[model samples]
Target: MSSYTKLRVAIEKPFGKDLSSAIELADSILGNLNSKEVFLIDHYLHKPGVSQIVEFCRSNPLLYSSAGLIDHIEIISSESIDVRGRTDYYDQYGVIRDMIQNHLTEILTLLTLDLSNLTSPSNRPFDLNAAKFDILKSIYPPFLQSAVFGQYSGYQDDLESDKGGNAHVNISTTPTLAIVVLHLQSPVWFNIPVIMVSGKKLGKRETIAKVVFKKTRHVSLRKKNGYCDDIVFTIQDSNGSSFITLPSNHNFNLPNDKTWTYNEGDGTSCSSMKTIPLGRMALKETYASVLRSLIRGESDLFVPLSNVLESWRIWSSLLLEYEEGKGEHLMIYNKSFLDNLRLTLNGSTLTVFVNSSDPQDNLVSFEKDGISFKSGNKTVEKIKEKIFGHFLYKFSRSSLAREISQDILDTAITSVQARDSFHLALPGGSSPADVYQSLVVDYKHSFPWTHTSIWQTDERCVPITSRDSNLFQLSKTLLAQVGVPYVNIHPLFPVCHKSESVLNEYASINYFDYVLLGVGKDGHTASLFPDSVNSSFSPFDNNETVKFVKLPLDYPIKVKERVTLSMERLVKARRIGMIITGKDKCHLAHVIESKDKHNSSLPFVQLLRKAKPGTVKIWMDRNICKK
Candidate 1:
């Protein structure tokens, strides 16, 4: 007998009210297992549920089967008034009834029994068909008066079938009805049965319990059972047939009689059969076969596993990157390190650590043989002159400005056209007001405005009409002038009206193709103010496309609740443009343009660092150059 001793049950409710009731029901049923302890988890709280279940299973190891137990139950309740005018709240249960009847437990028990039987082979070339028939006969004795199979059409159907093969059996018991299919020719042959054992309405079709099995050949018998030789398994399922092959040298282990043990040399072992959704199982099996071919050796496994492992690593890195106060550290890293970083693609926003500091002034660029940090600056006066020359004269030229502006516009247009639908996060404040106007005028005549959607980069908690609200400026400058339909424009609703819902609704749309922003003297852009309550605009560590922030600021013009597209969305954009003008902004611009890592303290530094290569273009005027 297996020394398993823990019971863990997971229950789901179709509605919130039924959650507690389902838990109560599960506890009652689990009580019958005679385990020392029972753990009932409610799925509504996903993380807590999984953690608690895992913890309970880990703590109690002797009362339940070694194999884990997961129970899913859904309950739907309704109420109605009868013809007599009396109102009644009727509780209707569907899958919940299946759970209470211990259907899952029974299925798991049967699976365990089947697995145990496969491990020890019979000496007399066990007739797979005969074995199935014998088991059925013993379980459903036809001569016994109280036998559950007495009323069912058993062997007659097998005899009358045109196939002339006894491959099917239908059984009806007090609490269950099922049809079992048996395949004798396959090495991996098992009874695939669809059982319906619920008290509620049967609905249109029968609920099923599908059992699948595969046989492993080339059984390797080793002293220590280290690794198995390539084994071919014939998979038999309710829907169809397939095959699974494991690498000959792949290291895998199965639980031994008293403890978990790994096979040393060549050994035969069955792969753990996972009961997943039919579609997923099919896909996994197909992929498994491909993996068997791909894994050449221990070193080769690293190639594929690396891809998988990198995904988790990226998540961990992102979490560390976004952890409060770690932004500065992430921004200090060089480009090569950032490029090799991996990240998961779950359609959620990802927090990126950007080195907002200028890359040109770094010690490596200055002292390194190949690159020089400052080509024109040997003294303070020369450095100041170069800053003034570049920011004042070079950046302000109409020719250069127009080139960058056109690049931004062209990229935005191309991206929107490619995606069919695109959103634009128009930042609030006077800085983007002119850019928005320019885009409106330029694109109105050259592009299809109808296909484009617009959202504010950030909004004040005040009404949309408020002067400080980004939506107000955008509406007056661009959205009001564009030919796009009203549905194409998503404006953040004022805080009084329900800001969260409004933000969520806007976030549901695809990320913007272009986000035009302006640099502030303090290095702040959009509504992202450093050390402000609105600083919540920081990119999320996950894959969400947008974020709503409530940044706090000391400056009157900067303080406000805002919603901004996350950095993940910004990086994902086809293009992003940062427009910088005015002499007061020169210091910040120069900081970002410099190679000093200290400059990363600026927010824009972070933005530039996190941006995908070639996606971001900084537009500046000579007047903004630092002297």
Candidate 2:
């Protein structure tokens, strides 16, 4: 679908690491008579929509952030159509290498480009490449481990047949669908998750880029009529109807001019201005611009070889995961629209139909970001004003359980498979117990129960027969159901407290492959309570793997005996999951996160300080984390 025509074509062999061999093949096959020009089309830069998106993303300060303030970027490109050519080429690269790795990735760079300090747009054109490269390097390239891949039904059928439909071959496992989450590690955008998804033969065909506003305290407008005011730009055609109406609209690739119209919708916080969302013609020209750049040797219109190689590296890693658990599709947001924000908190669900309709079949609230509510009765002030922690929150308990349990299983599977015996340390608490029970009951089938071993992070030094025992709680619930052998369960017995045998057994672990921990209201964890006398004798002083500390005979809990793992030991784990619940703990969670002097007595704070950048994740119930 380009206006320009190819005068000549040359592609001799499989496309991969070395592009030279193919170029060399042409030299010998036709004896290059001093070729005049060469071009490569990484066409994302040429699409009108992508171009305008990139331009606006790079140029505008109000809409996008140059200060790298973007909390997250979600890019989803699904099409109702399928490939119409030979399956051999399509099957080899699949949707990942064919579309996502190149085109979609380019869009990511444009969406997150850091041009904030650039005093002039003139310098940004050249600095853009460097900025993007820095962003990718900060993230250390998208890893294959963070993505999932799939194929539609006919994709395999096509792969089994030739162009003529005469011969048949074994069906190949090339993915026609890919969903990945990329993170940025820059100083300004650290730990930001950029979710990118692509597929063919899907329910609809639309390319979309949605930038989510951060959770920072943003101001809202309360309308005079008791409703909240908002603002937005709309695109219209000559008749002032929605700009895209018919199928032919897809072919309108001409330059935008005075014919295009723009207007404001809903709340008008800002003045109405002219704006045209990227159109098809503009998208087509986006790629066409690359063709022109190729003739001129302009790297501006394409991804560099280094960037391309980094993408391939990420894709290669993703291939291994897809090969094994491709069917374990999480469906994280498969049914949910990106624009619809449906949050469930403490039995209270607030759903805003900002952009999509599929969700709101039964929600109490509705409206778009820039539009006013149908009625002003449900004003923003009707709800109590409160400040949840300024931190991220997840309100759904089921979601929290699902995500954390899967994370544990994934880690256990990978670890136990890599080593003869993988160790997982568990903490005793309500939220942790809930997740453990969920894993034992609901997700029991998903665990690697054979090669894994369980270790209690802290134990009530009472007899296993005592109700105060941590192992007793785990055994009655998760351990009782799973098939993991009794020998694999390593419990810190009260007799082992202050005994060298405990230290020897704990030391043999090398490190816990996974750790499931919890945060208490007083900022305490693993029996290491703040302001407690034993807090001073904490293992953090010497980084001990295991510590035996006895509390006063009248200590707060029923049992005075305690045996616990140290921050030194938990930090060595391959991954850690901290489950925090109750909105009351949000402020405490924020304080514990700081690891300040006051929080130094908390064990979870110490573990976080010693852990790797991406090794630890806190799964808190949003009902507690939110106001």
Candidate 3:
């Protein structure tokens, strides 16, 4: 007998009335093996009598100690078996057997018990010829030397006379129905086979013990973990000849004979595998692929620009032709011809010089004898409002302003409709005020004006009635007149709350469709003053709305508090239209067309850089582009 520090016994069925005979038969066989631990499992607990038998062993420690044979005994209930009817008996038994072989159970107790106390039948009759054939058919032939069997007799059998039956005579055999014990003799079978027996008369085959061997084949591949291959074995009889080998190749059709050939002598081996590219390598490859296409001019990065510019030109020309007889109105054009314009890597810095015939030629010209325009403090404020105000009005108008504004407005409105929402940042001033009034007058009949919501681009920290209050002006000029449902309009309430909270609330909204913006002669838009204090604008914040800011200027004129959309929010708009009409705006407009980051100090320059491609349209009179 080999020494095992710990013994784990899993029973297929508990010692109950239905399984009493089978348990007795199994116990007799196990007794021969001198197993120290015996475990029983079944669906139902043992009867009262069986329970008492177990309790007796637990109470008397000294009488039933580990020194005795079968030192530990345990009984447990397993609900794994599901028996539907009489036909399911085999399946239920098979399930129970699998549980025992798989060692699925909680250890109820470790009690010292004596097997000797249990009554053993005086005799057991077994068919020796049948048992031998069964044993031979079950075990692998390579391990035939490990198989063994024995027989036993009681006193009555020894006393009985041979050939003739004597009075009070009894014949007894081994106390087991069948016993097949296999002691693995080969090194490969060492610690592999123990005991295996199966018989329908034994009350269903309960336990199935399987031996699993793990063989690993190493292959070179690019991966954090090496590849794994699996192979299965089916044992049928002794001498391995009755066994079948599982197919290893996925592509090959299995042979009917179920035999696998090991290619060891053929010098054939599995191919080395490759590892997937990861980390920086993968990103670099993807970016390089895209950049390469971009550089090759196979892909266009200015998607929106192409679409918007073409649409604007076509629509503007049509509107100009339609409104020809309406009135003498402003006409703005891209003053620089293609030959004079320059395209660069940084889109913000490009310079265009307009000819004298250009509408804005005199307005923005650098000639010493030209208009010689100056942007005073008041002029700057007025310009910012006018630019933004006119931009919005152009969208609402049917004239040339509307034609230019429609390109951007249509794109924005369409985008908003697709998303089921719309938003805009309208600054407080006469220009924006006029734009709103124009929107109410022009688009009220065409769009779902009642559904549109309005918000301030920036507000002064004052009551809504105050002249500086953007919300007050918008409400009076647009929101109130358009009859846009009050619920749709979200104004900064109290007009006195800290602008930050309002800005934060604005940022929480989803994308905005259109954001009407103005330009200051000093190159400021909204409340963002170029080279002034409180001009910081964050483009990295995840919030989708505008930010509020205060301006640094002279006392009584300095914007103490103002709300404005962040550059990020403005750029994110589907359409951004800038309206600049006066001659004072020519220099700033010139800067806008220039491709220089240093020129970004101009508010419009920043706006253009951040604007979605093709979505930005500058609607100006001939005066602003003159220089």
How many residue pairs clash in each candidate at the backbone level? 39, 14, 35
Write the candidate numbers in order of decreasing TM-score: 2, 3, 1
**Model 1 over residues 472-528: C-alpha lDDT tens digits?**
777787777878789877775543244556646755665567777777777777655
Candidate 3 C-alpha error for residue 393, in Å: 14
Q: Which predicted model would earn the best TM-score? A: 2
Q: Largest lDDT belongs to which candidate?
A: 2
Q: What is the lDDT of candidate 1?
A: 0.36
TM-score for each of the candidates: 0.35, 0.45, 0.35
| lDDT of predicted model 2 | 0.54
lDDT of 1 at 176: 17
Q: lDDT for each of the candidates?
A: 0.36, 0.54, 0.36
Error of 3 at 216 (Å): 63
Distance (Å) between predicted and true CA of 130, model 1? 89
Please state the error at residue 120 of candidate 1 in Å.
88
Error of 2 at 514 (Å): 9.5
Name model 3 segments beyond 4 Å from true.
1-400, 404-409, 493-496, 499-504, 532-548, 553-558, 595-598, 625-627
Model 1, residue 284: distance off in Å is 83
Q: Write the per-residue lDDT of candidate 2 for residues 570-589, one digit (tens) a residue.
A: 77887777777876687765
